[model samples]
Target chain A: MEENSKLSQFQPVKSIFEINREERMAPGHRACAGCGPMIAVRQILQSLDVKPVVISATGCVEVTTSTYPDSAWLVPWAHVAFENSAAVASGVEAAMHALKVRGELKEERPVIALAGDGGTFDIGLQALSGALERGHRMLYVCYDNEAYMNTGIQRSSATPFGAWTTTSPVGKEWPGKAEIKKDIMGIVVAHGTPYAATASISHWKDLMTKVRKAVSQNGPTFLHVYAPCNRGWRFEPKDTVEVAKRAVETRFFPLYEVENGRYRITVPVAKPRPLEDFLSLQGRFSHLLKPENLEVLKELKSIVEERWSKINAAASVQVQT
Target chain B: MAQFEPVQTRKSLLTGDEAVAHAVRQSSVDLVAAYPITPQTIIVERIADFAASGAFTGQFVPVESEHSAMSACIGGALAGARAFTATASQGLALMHEMLYAASGLRLPISMAIANRALNSPLNIHNDHTDVMGSIDSGWIQLFVENAEEAYDRVIQSFRIAEAVNLPVAINLDGFTLTHSTEPVEMLSDEVVRGFVGRPPKRDSLMDEAPKSFGLMSLPDSYQFFKDDQSRATTGSSVTISQVEGEYAKLSGREHGPLKIFRPGSKVMMVMLGSYAGTARTTARRMKNDGEQVGVISLGWLRPFPEKQFLDALEGVETLMIMDRSVSYGAPAGPLASDVMSLLYRYGIKRKVIAVTYGLGGRGFLEEDAMRLFRYAGKSGSSFESFFFYGGE
Candidate 1:
């Protein structure tokens, strides 16, 4: 597990402007400047080869993009509620099939569901599981910001250990969050999805590639994209991308994909940076760096290392086969 | 042109649930997304059988839960498909949030609710508690008296919803209408097709003209959207009457939103759902016994059939209203509250005896209806109003 094993490598792209695709998400919407999830949203729309109908669960992206009387979406978009985007997309896919069978529609468009970590890992887990298990021809993208940022930094299952969220405050008895981040990708993979991947906004090329591959399949695909929130993490807006990049470098959030039950580490880390390098940049983790909380910091590092080793093992087995 | 000619019909004995499924089968629906729940389970089961046998060619999605069921219906409708779903009691309660979502989006999806009681000790019995709780969810509510009305309303509900650009719920009593078999005169597929016609074209998610749906509204425009929805719902009475008029011409069955049996009586008994049949029979027997009594059954509750309901109560000075559900901390029952409000609006002073009965699938016989009517008609007992029947 100590040896860095690379299965698939992504070429470093010089700029996002080189990819010649129409920007389906219009500019001048309500998203905050330096918002990490909006970057993922823009790239996902640009990566799509077909005209896709988008289903959005209630969150930052949905509220910001879809204010009444005006919408930032240049394509068909819908925001149903907070927890039912997957099920809504399933219905849209089924309707597309039905319409095609009846010859009412000339061609079938792809269906995509977009939600946050709160929607995906917690409230929407059942719906996501149902959509994946039913094998709907759609792609579900979870833009994880680690907590419920829209509701003002409430702790979610996706909130990491030692993170200071409103619901998981740093108190005398409790350092920060008492629980580790939920393994949502594992839960999704256990559904036997044809394609599932973990991505980060820092790696735009890798994230876009996975999006294209996901929609090309004739079954459900899942993409869990790590989005760094400057507001929630109490970091400067300019440091959003830097913070995300450090997360990947520390192996805190790995970039990987699984296709047909085979795992492939997309961006393998040769030598991971120290966990403190990532934690020092954000105020949410500043309390954990104190001398009195050094033990909690040590535990977090071990947890991160253990998760990285598991991914390395899973990818290495595929290489050996 | 089809309305000018004689229509061919077939007679079959069907429970209310089967009748709704048959309507769906013949309605040329594009999708039926539902989850199985008691009483209403047969509706989806029958739709599944129809899908299996090729009688219904629509997409039938057995969703994981009622919340997902309603969500899928909203999605399907947004994608320009005529979607339908069914649930009962707890299932409807589970779908309460999405009910507002469906109507707020103005998706025009039709649903059949096998009216059942909400559970505390978990009873699967007939009551109006589920839909009563969702009364403010903004969907057009239609109450059916029997299997035939359930079948007819299911078809009419589609046209009504589509015409008004809103969702409609056909409320049929759980077990009483859903399980009890009754003879229904089903219109032929051709006649039914002609009656409903093809769905009108609208701006949909799949159309060439791209538009966003279910957008968030802040304080600036939220009230406008709700005002528009409210106007559309209340204004649906005109469209409803027009569609029912057209349907009556074709099927020779003319049951409007409000029906009066033995109108112009001094004392009237008003209620909704299948119990109206009992009230009708009981009212007749009491009239023969030299009592001035009548029965009024309302089919549409949301739009409230205000004008016709008032006109039917021309000479009535007293009303004995029966409610199958209770409204805790309110002045009266759900239906009675609406009636009282309508009376207050019109400045019509009538003594109202608000009574609750037949809860949790309990049987309501002719004796119960006659006893309530007699109790309300008694001269000196008028002071003691607003009580429950068959209860301590």
Candidate 2:
């Protein structure tokens, strides 16, 4: 496990410039500066070779693109209610099938569903589960910011343990968010999706490659992308990618994929940068300077490392994604 | 004595539910998220048989619950497949969340609701309560009266839904219409093809590339998405009538959002589903002896068709809103409340009375319809009236 953790981070280059400068996400939009989700989408769309239909929930991505008719999206797009993006997308995909079987749509054009942590982890899970179970050739990409950023950054199931959201504020022996982040990728994999991967913005190349593989490969593909938030995490605008990279280096967010049933690490940040090296840069962990606080944070990193090792092992337990 | 016009190329004997199933097959819907309940079982059963016999290539998910049924349907639809689903009564009620989701996304899809009264004490019979329960879920709802209308309406639903890029539900009474077999002029494959036509665009949510369909929404985006949904559904509200008009050009039978059977009567009785047919029967009896009674069959329920309804009811001195559902509390039953609300909004307040009929879907027979017309004749302000017809 130690040897695997130190493996060099995988980087795929051709996908980077392969993206069209004419972004599917148009230029004029309503997003905060250095928005991680939008950047993740940009990298993702770069990998897609076809004009895809985009379904988004009522989140930051949705608000930014569709604001009173002037959509920032260059592609055909729709924004459904918060909890049913998966369901709404399901209808669109079904319609396409009907059209194709009866000779309506050509055998091309990919469909993708983009959701936030709150939508995928909490409200929209049932619909997502059904979509994966149906085995429709669609990809579900969750831009995880760890909280409900669109709804004022409230704590969600995806919120990591000890993170301080408004609700999980740092106070009186309270360690902010109490529970560990829900391993949603596991739940998605349980649905028997053909492809599942955990990626982050720190590794844009890896993210894009996995996305391409996900959509091109048959059946349902799920890409859980860790996107850092400047506002949510109280980090500098320029540190979005830096913080993401630190996350992987400190073993907070590991890059891996579950194909069929086998697990493969796209980029193993196993050499392990000290947890302090990552936390010192973020305002969210400012209070962790106390010696005892540092101990707890170290414990958290240990948990993340242990979890990744098991995940890597479990990936090999299954095959044929 | 029978005379044949030979207007339709083909005909078939079937129930309303069977017609709906056949129409689903003819349309080649990709997935069916079905939650089978009584009287509505045949629709799913026939479709299931079709799938089993290698007839339909789509996935017909037999969901454990109505919520899951809609969930599966939505998933398949998102994957860029033609989808269909059926539900009734408690099952329809169970799919409450998904109903809003399906419409809010503005997906061009269709559903068949075997309308039945909801239960507390438990009853599985024909009524509008089930469909009425979710009438405001932003769907383009079309109520059908007979087997022929049911079949024709199912096909028309797809056109209406696809044209406006909205979800549509074809509502019909449970056993009253769904189980009652009747002669229906089933369209031949060629004529049906000519009328329905293929999907104009194949812009599926699913393509081979990395395109995302449905995504989670936040507060910053929920309202705008909802606004778009409302626009599409309301647009469909108007478009459905036009689709029906065009359908009439080819099928020779038509129904609209607000189909005014006989307007300009001093008194009018409104109804939906199979009860509309009975209400029309009762209206004719009442009008024969100059009773000044007429019937209005409501089809598209969501947009409410405010101006159209007000105009139809303007000449009438008295308006009786008869619904086959209960609202539990407040004044009028579901239909009556919506009508009165519309009238009040338009500042055209006439003598409007409300009454609830067919609780648990016992029956909305001709006598019940006559009784409602008679009640409309005798002007009263019993806004929360429940009629226990022919009780011991």
Candidate 3:
């Protein structure tokens, strides 16, 4: 009962658009018109109440917002390099404590590390694990666009099975990527983070609430946000959010949270929509719809179902014994 | 120079690593983010002891890798903290990428490099090869010949880095200086505090004013930043000297870009690190034996100290450059190549030989220095050349 009360302080934003809060990310940036990660960044920044020092990995968000002469960030932002955002945030958090020790700083600002999927799930995994294990008071947000969208869509570990990336292109003999997406949330939770979750741009309210709860934690927290890339996924730019929502509704990407080893389905889908509703909107998975790739489609569906069942079991309210 | 009594000190036996730890502890660093690599591990371990015993109040982050160590230092520096880290050889190689980032961002973070040989057969011993790998990384590199100089340079590095807004690397020879204990005079914490002076509040992420750092640059403005970095490095020589001058007032000890022993001798032998001490002793003995020999320790490798080097080269007709690292297919070793380049730039012609020696931490005996000095003394040929000195 007391554990439930610990999470009660986080007030969820009822709706993102209804709030008249000033945008933390300034306009006139270089992000694409329907950039999904940009929307996630905006909502994440808007959700924060306390001043935050944002550390970014080298990716689309860093490049687009922080061009040489101008920057779109209205808050303290740092982009060090690829594969070390978590490590950098660890330093910043440590510095905040040290500064307070020396009486140089009064109030310690929160630290939020942002990275793309490539930075989070692949080259950056070790650093992220170290940061989380060290229990630094910081929030790490991985905007999972499924591939290295900054350097033109190379397949990352976060890329779903059978998705056609530039590296995993469709060929006569070769299909698309053969492997399934890595279970990053499982990896993050294994580090015993105080809070870790999966969210999407479509569910801004849940995402914002998670951000608030993450910042309020005394130790490390993580958010694996499903950021759909329009150009990389080869979808109509305007349908980025719709495709993201389809991912959630189809059970392909579930919205959930793992708090102190306890799992809860924050947004449960009792009856998932057809998987086709999600895959059909993005060209990366269009090859899976063909009859020749019917087995691959079935395999993907079974995998998603198995994952959904597993998460549902984990988050079940019934007594396991 | 202003006249003042040197700060009171007590002498204690300390290794190069311990000397650096003492300096860092006294400098009031806000954060120390470092990974343990041999030859440099003692530094972090001693600082850890300081933190545990309450002698040092700074935060110590045992980072996962050298790359993360540097990355974290950058983060701490950006947050307006006095940041430090230490590494050697393979660790420095791993951190090669972020070294440029730290300097390019103009973060005044200081680092200590226990100079060691890079791995081929995976050896860990004293050599300049490790630091030479980063010769072009746009950092102010200071070389120390012994524990005392290591102690002095570590303190002076913070002043130089903060003054010029560039990172400083104080390189002490692995095992040779890092493990060898010497009586090092210590400065009080209050004295070091007065010297470095509160880290000089820079624009930080923690500041009220929001700012962006490490921005992406297109072709048009990329070179402008690089040019600025280049100028800042070349211009840091002034701050380097000025800091040493101030440190001299308090510590009564000062080191310059070049330490010349027996200046204006027709035959001059030059090197860096602990072996330079051997060369200096050899030169003194040979001078007493009626040989016109000179020895120079090139202390600062970066900023190259063009004018000072040229000045030291005056009336020195024969130059034997002792390098602990190979440049591999270049005309000479790394140090010899730089000196040769400096001479060529000025059209100063002389008999110059680049002799590579003490590689992979091979001990450089005083007799070895004597042999090099005697060899340079006998060489009658004019012009420049290169060779291995310790080969069978």
Best by lDDT: 3
Model 1 misplaced stretches (Cα beyond 4 Å): A1-18, B1-9, B380-384
1 versus 2: better lDDT goes to: 1
Per lDDT, what order, best first? 3, 1, 2
Better of 2 and 3 by lDDT: 3
Per-residue lDDT over A283-311 for candidate 2, one digit per residue giving the tens place of the 0 to 100 score: 77776666667665766777777887787
Candidate that scores best on TM-score: 3
lDDT of 3 by residue, A1-321 (tens): 012233335666777664438789999999998999999999898886666899999999999999989999999999999999999999998998898877888878879999999999999998999899888888999999999998889999999888999998887766798889999999999888889999999998999888988877888999999999999999999999999999999999999999998898999898899999999998898999999999889999999999998888988853363
TM-score of each: 0.95, 0.81, 0.96
Ten contiguous residues minimizing lDDT sum, candidate 3 chain B? B1-10
- Model 1 docking category: medium
- What tens-digit string does per-residue lDDT give for candidate 1 at A198-299? 988888988888887787777889999999999999899999899999999999999999999899999999998999999999999999999999999999
Candidate chain B TM-scores, in order: 0.96, 0.90, 0.96
Q: How many pairs collide in each candidate, listed in order?
A: 0, 46, 0
Could you tell me which residue pairs clash in candidate 3? none
- Angstrom error of the Cα, residue B101, model 2: value is 6.5
Fraction of native contacts in model 1?
Answer: 0.70
| DockQ, candidate 3, vs. native dimer | 0.82
TM-score of chain A of 2: 0.91
